[model samples]
Target chain A: MRIEHELHARRRSRNVGLGLVLLAFVALIFALTVVKVRQGDLMEAYDHQPRVSLTPLDTPAGAPAEETPAGVPAEEAP
Target chain B: MTDINAYDASPEGEFRDYVALLKPRVMSLVVFTAFVGLWVAPGQVHPFIGFCAVLFIALGGGASGALNMWYDRDIDAVMNRTRSRPIPSGRVQESEALGLGIVLGTISVMMLGLVANWFAAGFLAFTIFFYAVVYTVWLKRSTPQNIVIGGAAGAFPPMIGWACATGGIGIESILMFMLIFVWTPPHFWALALFMKEDYHRAGVPMLTVTHGRRSTRRHILAYAVALAPFAIGLGLTSIGGPLYMAVSVVLNVAFLRGCWQIFRRSEDQAIADDYAVEKRVFRLSLYYLFLHFLALLVQSWLGGW
Candidate 1:
């Protein structure tokens, strides 16, 4: 009877450990998916805004200007 | 009542404790600055990439914080400010913190590269290395100038933010970097002025412990004087305008006056006031950086600079 009881306890402990590992893996996957969805929304928003390029040195004094540098390629401009 | 499994010294891992391991205060600053950087970039970035950039930057920042905690677990146990940290408080294992830090650091850098330009991603990777290895591992215990040099680690986010938008570095981004670099010493020294005992207890070799409070006070004044010009100079840049200039003038004058008061204070007076002036200045210094960045954003929006 004693031998049988010890075997049952070992089996239960292993099963609990396996359950915790699976739980942690699932949580990590869920967090990553949420981050991905948020990124998708932001990308869509960026596409909707008007794009301009202006350097800090190029703005005239006292005037509110977008200050895009002349002659810089648009595709490469940030 | 059946004995409930309530207060095990080692309860199966709690979620809140894991979050605490990230050093949320530092992470918040990292996120804020990185956002400002993204916002202030010259052209529009796809909002998705921008979000990814900020997320990765923040994770990188958290990774450094985690690693710092892991490596400093010994000193953390000794300091009052850090005594309750996850690792030091026995809430999380040191190895767990290390593993989390390394895994997060790798993921943040790789994801940043995949989603953003390689330049921005590269900068993120370097920043993690600078904070974790150069500042935390090498400098913290070695010299009085630790904060001076380590300040570079904190200053990189704005530059990285700039890179994310433009795919290149520029004079304005460099100026933004300089502004924080100059501000760090005075802001930190003011805290060191009051917390000298903590440094002494931790044997961390802070300026207060090595050079004495008077010298630290002088250094604070010097750095504050230097910072004024840099802060105001940003006004002359394409990013600057009347709003930024006005904010810069008022804040710089107040900061100078605060530093002057700290310098002129006698030890007896400081003790009598319980270092009230130093404590207040320290609080103001926190506002000082945040306001500068906010002013920049406001100027960019209102003045369209």
Candidate 2:
């Protein structure tokens, strides 16, 4: 019986390595997913919130800065 | 006088069998790429919404796996590498895999649309169909170019991720798609080189099985050389930075060299070394994509984005 079970386990998990890979990934996703929308807040969020900002990332190497969201309006640009 | 779950004659399998049908390893890759897609996109996703989006994408990937396993069971039973898979082993039934595939695939698409955007959900739906039907049913048995074209299915995750964030596509997302699409051929061909026997026995017309090893080797080299520009171009995109460029340069050089070694090897030399060089290249291919994406993620974490 034990022999049969071992053979079954061997064939079953074929690449236990892959299973490990999956578990590690799930754990990582779980860790990263800090907030959960209980009542399906998807539409409201997608309708209102833009997950990534649309602002341009760069202004040619020597361009002057404007609308510094990262800094106080009165303070000097870092 | 029969039980339904006993669709296969074996010990009725276990809880793990259901998970096995999902091909968790492939799901991991999809989850990683999709999360990176959402993370690196120009805007910010609410934490909860982002979670739901990635979850649905992951489930969708799993559903594709179940379907693949269900359909491929016949050939899978013939291939040593896949014979032990649940459906083929009869530990879990084909009917069970099909059911799981439909249920999970539907739920995932609907939820992704609800949580992300319709465009992203639609993209996810297309990806599932492309993988389950177009690639598996239509492509796998029919041609040597199966992976070359079918690679599109694997390449869509990051694009879907990008859509989840911005609700549309851009050159950066397209380039991301191109990087994976181009990367798939060389990656799988190298594995096929080593495992051609399994493909031959299974009657799957993998490039290595249909084309001789020498030809497959040349193709690997061609793709490795071709993959360079897209990978580097991606590094120059909004998502790229000095760090990405450095990593890309180093990795690309090593990648080209690996392919060169494989290309130059005679069958005699390969057999002598037990295809050691081919095996090494195959393993490196896994790291190649991961580091590229990881560098992008790290760059973003460091505010390069």
Best by DockQ: 2
- Which docking class does model 2 fall in? incorrect
Q: Which stretches of candidate 2 lie over 4 Å from their true place?
A: A1-78, B1-11
RMSD of each: 11.3, 11.0
Error of 1 at B182 (Å): 1.2
Q: Write the per-residue lDDT of candidate 1 for residues B140-160, one digit (tens) a residue.
A: 899899999899989999889
lDDT score for residue B284 of model 2: 95
Candidate 2 on B72-176: residue-level lDDT in tens? 989988877788998877778778899989999998899788667999999999999999999999998999999998899989999999999999998889988
User: What does the lDDT come to for candidate 1?
Assistant: 0.82
**TM-scores for candidates 1 onward, in order:** 0.78, 0.79
* DockQ, candidate 1, vs. native dimer: 0.04
Summing lDDT over every window of 10 consecutive residues in candidate 2 chain B, give the lowest-scoring window.
B3-12
lDDT of 2 by residue, A1-78 (tens): 333444455455646755785696577456434343343333233333232333345657677545544434435534
Q: How many backbone clashes does candidate 2 have?
A: 8
